[model samples]
Target: MEDVIVPIVLFSVLPVCIWLVSYFNYRKRLTAHETVRHAIDAGQTVSPELIEKMSLLVDPIRADLRRGVLFIAFGAAFAVLGMMVNFEDGDALMPMLGVASFPVFLGLAYLGLWAFGHGNKSA
Candidate 1:
């Protein structure tokens, strides 16, 4: 029962955590935009630099590259875990490899996107 519960909680919590982070980030951006709107209504000069600083935009290609590396590393860690578990029990490796493949393929896709977008200014 504990084993089943632990896995269930872990998988469930991951999506919740991701959602929370995205929610908070959205709220932050909303607040920032509201502040800018208020300042504009007050007839204050809002400079482009100030907006740029507040926006904190990251390069999409660079972000993709970073995510790709991180996902690949994460997948590699899972693969290593699978190998270690396999040493203890023979049946664990294949299932873990199957699980690891998702992240690895996702990482490869991100890397491919990064590569394709690297040369394009609009990307």
Candidate 2:
């Protein structure tokens, strides 16, 4: 029972965490964009300072994605290893967890790419 529960929790909780982190990052970026919009509406010039601040806002997402990608790669490797081991013992949970990690990482990667590609709204 404990063995199954531990693996289940590990499999489920991590994906949830990854998702929540990505969601919060996206929300934060939207909030920052709104702030910039407000600043522009107030007749503030689009100075270098403002641009620099906006660029800084993306650092967190990039860091998170980099970390997420690494975890996904590691999870994939572990999943393959687990599948190989389970051939004899016949458990599928760990391999499932391994497969699940890839999407989370891919999502995070896409988020990063989107942010970087569209970051400059005021060119």
Candidate 3:
């Protein structure tokens, strides 16, 4: 049970925690962008301060996406390692390898979201 469970916990929890962190970070940046956009929409001058902050906020999301991808990759590698090493005959370690794909899929999904968000193109 430990063999099966430990990997699941690692493959599942690590990415989720990282995703949550990235999500919160993205949300914070989004809120700031909206605030700046609202200010601009209101007929107020686009201050240099707000422009600087917006630029800074936007730059990190790409980096965070990359970091999330890296975390997924690491999880996959760990899963592979887990699969190759046989602890007991009845152990279902390969299933855990499959489980690792969840994070990879999540990272790809986030990348897709990042791409979709590009240029703020709205219909």
lDDT of each: 0.87, 0.74, 0.74
Could you tell which candidate, 1 or 2, scores higher by lDDT?
1
Candidate topping lDDT = 1
Number of backbone collisions per candidate, in order?
A: 0, 0, 0
Clashing pairs in 2: none
Could you give candidate 1's per-residue lDDT for residues 2-99 as a string of tens digits?
Answer: 99999999899979988996897678778888989999999999999988677654457876898899889888989999999999999999999988
Order the candidates by TM-score, highest first — what do you get?
1, 3, 2
TM-score of each: 0.69, 0.46, 0.46
Ten consecutive residues with minimal summed lDDT in candidate 3? 114-123
Global local distance difference test of model 3: 0.74
Residue-by-residue lDDT tens digits, candidate 2, 3-77: 999999988998998799989989988998888899899998788888787877776555655666776667677
Candidate 3 residue-wise lDDT, 1-123, digit = tens: 999999999889969987998899879888987898898899999978868767766564565568568768867886876667646534758777776777777777767766765555341
Relative to the unseen true structure, what is the C-alpha lDDT of residue 110 in candidate 3, on a scale of 0 to 100? Answer: 69
